[model samples]
Target: MEDEAPVIYGLEFQARALAAQAGETDQIRFIVGTQSLRQENQVHHIDFDDENNVINKNVFMHREGEMWHISASTVDKSLLTTCYNKTSESKAEMRAALWRLPGDFDDVQSEDQSSHQSLSLVCHLDATDYGDMKSVMWHPTGDNSNVVGLADNHIVVWDIDTSGNSAQMTSSAGLESKGQPKLTCSSWDPHHNCVQIATANDTFIRGWDLRTMQQTYVIENAHGQLVRDVDFNPNKQYYIVSCGDDCKVKFWDIRNVGEPLKVLSDHSHWVWSVRYNRFHDQLVLSSSSDSRVILNNIVSLSSEPYGNLIENDEDDDDDADDRESREASPPQDGVIATYEEHEDSVYTVDWSTADPWVFASLSYDGRLVINRVPRAEKYKILL
Candidate 1:
């Protein structure tokens, strides 16, 4: 069995330090994909010092066959400046400055979505129209060029053109059904030609046709509590998984509106985020307030137990052998493994497009843990 170790690509943290007589100062540091998990581990520290005169937030990365880049942002009352580090030295310097400015600045998350090319989309959370910028998803076509943003109260589409500009293609308002409010998490359907968009609110998962801007389907009471996260499998678009404050992860078949295909109730607390692995439709990664990351196997349609899940289980003595056979069959899907690394609530978890086994987790404590998805083996007993 050949398994590739996980990649620790980037890390962001807050670090606080106290000087002899200078008092305290807080600074943010980001370590890029330079050192391996053992050496430097791509972890950065963030913090604010006592002086409060200057605020420093920096982004650092050492790319393969390339020079290191460290970006810095300093805050002062109403002014903010961003500059890049261009020196062999790791500390802030004068000659290595790349750019400077005066304006409001927000933290930029790591961007490299895949090994081929990196993609990034930014939203003004405090801006009037965008409001909160709740969720974001990349176009499912694997183009990595376009993005669809679900904001405070709007659905905005950005088409990445050749000139390096994201053109806003469309924006839609909210719905007032049973006080369901507006969209929170939106995704481009993976099974189709990016023609359908699915969004979740406090109570419903609604589907809309991109061509007609009409509701195609709606699953009400999708989650008993506030639907916190929803995601479409990159490989299985018709199927989606949603987790909520209700403390349940439900799998749904968009075509079958009545009920979820399966309900995976393992997390002890609210499920905050869920995502499908780019490499395998059967593999999924989910994070929860329980401080654990769960790896699940989504049963394929080809599996017999899948179809029978929504079917009645009625067996007579004459069919005893058949029932035994069915009992011996493997599960529709099973828990592959669980990574209990984060000490606090894990807020976000993402799979590496470059490596299938590689995944990363971010927690409320600001600790980022990157590791490989371990493989599981089954043991059998003969009678």
Candidate 2:
């Protein structure tokens, strides 16, 4: 008997291993990073494009005046990308700039669309005092021109109004209580008119109503271990899903706080990310620490999952219903699709709003997949 090569996408792929027997067979070799902390540890951190002059480690888009501005997150210094028309062809190339600031943000008002048609630098923000920003998000309204960020677990909401001087209006939350760590993930509720945001930590998930400045809802012990990601359905306010180091993807109805509406336990390792397809409420996609992506049908929890079936009211002489009840139904199997492309752990996965079938995945081994979502074509497109 002879050894065979590994396969990918139904085709055999071969690679040479560092250690091989004298005349036996070849093996696959794995490469280690030269700039690694420990030779065996995988270091996966965010990296900016070296070709671009901007030095900020993170980037986001914000609206100012009548155009849109792309900004960077930097500590002690302030740099911004040039402005571009909100709906024009030249919006793609506006590169970001970096500098110092006087306060939280720069007052750059929206411009008049008819007269000020060109995309250029309208103004700059004073981000020096903002301090180590862990994450940033643009105002979803597209008119208020506010930018929100999380720093040391404190939320900073920036109002980009010009009457306020170089620095603009700022609001802070979650700062009263000290000794709080930065919330790892902050997600805006797309279903609530985009006026609410939710944050996740080791033991809890907190929802904040941006317009009311109130803590809307809190899920205690969202996971026994750290909750890696939290997401809300685009049209369902009563529902949310969470995944974590516990290796479980839980679906919650918010109505019940004691337990999840359903607990999916199929992943062999910790779940890194879980996403609901906005186009279809019944389809959920998840990426895990097992180096695989799983697609699941969300309707398995429903009372009448397969829809109404014709029922015969007449009693049968053979007692068929009694006999059928004695046979136990099989346990639920979670996975609908399993993708095993990445050689390392998959960290994140997101579905495109413009194209639901198209999704993206980022992995610890520096692999990015931007193709049709697995089994997306088989499911109904609800969007």
Candidate 3:
């Protein structure tokens, strides 16, 4: 007989973007949004163990604004918090703040067991230049000195290290098509040597090389409807994945931008976000407006051995048949799991960088759920 595998635990919250600490696998953080009646928003940090027990919990930030987007710094374990105050029907102000863990912070226990310390505000910038900020991201490399923000019709880059008082917007890029709808989402390309960004606007995904301050590549009508989110594969340089209002996920190779490498249509409603598993190259997760989170296995669909047909000189007719067979083969995406716990539309889903099995999902109804991938090996042993 074999012992039972450990059962994973989940914690729920009222938040938007849930980010795991850079080097700490057990630490997770997120920010709550302001309610329509002007209730205050907050940032939360939680520490959990392998068995899903909550070790420590703290409120990192408490303020009077709505957090539109939040990103955790990969290099320094800090957080980039972006928020806005809607003053009137058509007037709003946006701000970005950097928060860091205090030096005397303890993962074990504090002298005051009843009190928890808040995260220290390193610096913050308030600007009226960019209104209605939609997304924010930290540069993957360069010691995380650079941050990017996307707003109505422009993108702004900030230099946190060089600026003495607070992070300053160093440069700005305006959308080529000015009158179109504001940018929907933006992602930093992890594999590019320099700073390269991919942004979704309406039905197109545009790639920008920040080094040259130019648009490098653009995919026209990347989706049937408005593109919601775009993410690049961390393992492969030119590979990208995007989700859109059409309830479809599309994959693209930047080198060949004419068509998507594959299109995955599984979600029944608008797919809001898509993420690639950091540890497993084959796994991708998406959250949709249908109140479900889906896990997809795309290794067979994207790998060359399964997607491409072999050619042989011995049989010309066989080679032609093989080509036809390859063209007729459907996408090899398999839905391994579906999570339907959230009562509202799930807006965000993120995978933990340190833990392979742990992930988090958040919904518009102020519900957040932490989940673990079910493993059969943990439950049974083969004899």
Q: Pick the candidate with the highest TM-score.
A: 3
Model 2: weakest 10-residue lDDT segment is: 15-24
TM match of model 3 to true structure: 0.81
lDDT of 1 by residue, 277-329 (tens): 66565677788889998988765632222344432347444476666676667
Residue 378 of model 1, lDDT score: 16
Which ranges of candidate 3 are over 4 A from the true structure?
Answer: 1-14, 23-37, 52-56, 86-90, 102-119, 142-144, 162-165, 301-332, 376-383
Alpha-carbon shift of residue 223 in model 2 (angstroms): 0.3
Reference-based TM-score of each model: 0.61, 0.58, 0.81
* Model 2, span 174-214: residue lDDT tens: 73333564566666676656788887766678788887667
Segments in model 2 whose C-alpha atoms lie over 4 Å from true places: 1-131, 139-144, 160-169, 175-179, 300-333, 374-383
TM-score sort, best first: 3, 1, 2
Per-residue CA lDDT of candidate 3, range 152-253, in tens?
Answer: 777888788533547877888888784757899998998857479999999989999887668999999999999999888887778889999999999899
Alpha-carbon deviation at 334 in model 1, angstroms: 2.5
User: What's the CA error at residue 55 for candidate 2, in Å?
Assistant: 26
